[model samples]
Target chain A: MTDLSQQLAFVLEIDKLKAVYRQTTVKEDKDRHENSAEHSWHIALTAQILKDYAEYPIDIERVVQMLLIHDIIEIDAGDLFAFAEQQDHAQQALKEAQAAERLFGLLPPQQHEQYKALWFEFEAAESNDARFAKAMDRILPLVQNMNNNGGSWAKHKISQPQVLARNKHLEYIAPKLWQYVVQQTDLAVSNGWLKKD
Target chain B: MTDLSQQLAFVLEIDKLKAVYRQTTVKEDKDRHENSAEHSWHIALTAQILKDYAEYPIDIERVVQMLLIHDIIEIDAGDLFAFAEQQDHAQQALKEAQAAERLFGLLPPQQHEQYKALWFEFEAAESNDARFAKAMDRILPLVQNMNNNGGSWAKHKISQPQVLARNKHLEYIAPKLWQYVVQQTDLAVSNGWLKKD
Candidate 1:
């Protein structure tokens, strides 16, 4: 009813994120898929660790915030596989926007708007911070796939071209990580971890 | 190794954190225990959401950074149960310091020092940022226990005095949240969720 109640409610509600599993598996626990909560944590840390590689000066804090809250929508909308063959971007966007409204609405009014805006900025990937945050989002799982012998990339029979195309925006956002991703993709192909196109 | 290699190595290595489970369970998924990675994420977000409640002017970014990398040592040192009747904090400090060296060392030399320093700062919990971050860490699991019908508290036969004693530092760092915890503990005791000492 009050602000603290709303804050606690929001905090408790987001715990559901820990249950929303992604296709990618953890390095040590290959049998278990990484959940949205941990995925958010890893990428927020990744954004900070890789801040120097960003193409533009960015607010590392804002980037971390975006990365942290970006997947709260998945608490309700559910994780859509990044490598899925057919993605209804419009439909997914609508679902996530609705999820954002409900999830962020659980916070106090100011934070509700602030977090909702950050989530939108992350979805749009327009600002330097948002772009860098999005880059961290894509990059972590790419390497996680490498860690688990191709992980979901191999599971879904994904090709190198698809991986490159999905992550092509990295070239502009983070040229250094783009180079790293390209090199890793080459290694994955040679090692038969990622299928050749 | 080049800085890039070291950075990527750090990124890949911390994925092991996802496998390090904590004593708390997720609200929706009571059957599963929360892992260190997600716990880090939740507390970092919690620090941001509750920044206004801090006793002093704190850098939310530093708080988030501290929370994000704090548990990373669990990748090597393993999680020490907060409710354990007898804690060898001295041994934990030694093990975690060593773990910090190996884990943070995976990064470039600069981050290795930066993260290691932040980890130590968090462990000390003396600074404004560190205290707030530490508060979030304690409060999250406290409420998770309440959410899941006195989760680890019931399982470990923990008591009111134990919970209050464990989180007593919140009184100085975050008065509002400390009050909230006191109230919640009273309710938890009345509801028979938590046992009386």
Candidate 2:
């Protein structure tokens, strides 16, 4: 197939991301679950809006690209809940890796390398952009959970410590946002939406 | 307010993009209109997948970033339909410019500059990256119109020449994709999805 056709096919296929529901809900809209596509778009927009708070200055463009394609594998591997500990990690990783290869591989060779690298960089969370992106990824759902009266946290019986542990890396990546999270988690505890123990 | 709070505020606010519907519908799902957020995510993914088809060797990352943030002004300005001619051009441009300033200005100064500049680059459509991004932006809707049995094209009574004119720039930006589009338009015209005269 021509590169354009391949690309169009990929575009149509990845729309499935909209159907892959996540554990998080929209912060403003509590009526439904947020899909991976919406979450990815939100974080990309968030990365641009929040770049300054990162511990390191980042290439905002690269960070935006990472967020755009990062969760695409979820179209195949499915969204794993941050609190769901019942899954097999090795199997999930294997499925996602395969998903990444199949999905990113749908692009031309050079473009495929570009996105695959970005996904790896995001997963490793070592680069400055990746680190900042990771912080935004972790922080947003926490805020959503808090705002929606502990949303997924309440639904899953997620404890405050569980929330804190999942996002503790935010302190290193985005200190100020982590502070905001701490304040909100306390508020959530007081509101009886989050488990104190 | 601290930068993180501002960032979180911006993220929560931009969720409104999910509520902003576009003229296009998802190629896979025709029951509802595609939201601006989903459209942005789709084009960004399309940019990466089809970068090779660009007449110029473009910076795919920059193109992805542009597509991700380009429609965000729509959050404030609202989406303008490609076939809609009743709107005032100067007034629409003014609203979008103001929207760009307000929406992008939600970021820290540096990020605000980065995104504002990218948004302008996309609007100008002079850069290789922006040109390719524009082609993807145009092609998707055309495909969607084709997929949904003439969709807005039929609804708006859009002619083939009108469709051709709106997307003429694609020929210069992405020759191969433009060829694909020409072939599709021929099919569309024959099928009466697009008016021939």
By TM-score, the best candidate is 1
User: What's the C-alpha lDDT at position A121 in model 1?
Assistant: 90
Worst lDDT run of 10 residues, candidate 2 chain B, spans B23-32
Show model 1 residue runs off by greater than 4 Å.
A85-87
The local lDDT score (0 to 100) that residue B44 gets in candidate 2 is: 80
Tens digit of per-residue lDDT, candidate 2, span A88-111: 666778898999999989876777
- Which of the CAPRI classes, incorrect, acceptable, medium or high, describes model 1? high
Among all windows of ten consecutive residues in candidate 2 chain A, which has the lowest summed lDDT?
A: A24-33
Residue B106 local lDDT, model 2? 82
Error of 1 at A169 (Å): 2.4
lDDT of 2: 0.79
Off by over 4 Å in 2: A27-30, A56-60, A88-90, A124-129, B27-30, B56-61, B86-90, B109-114, B126-129
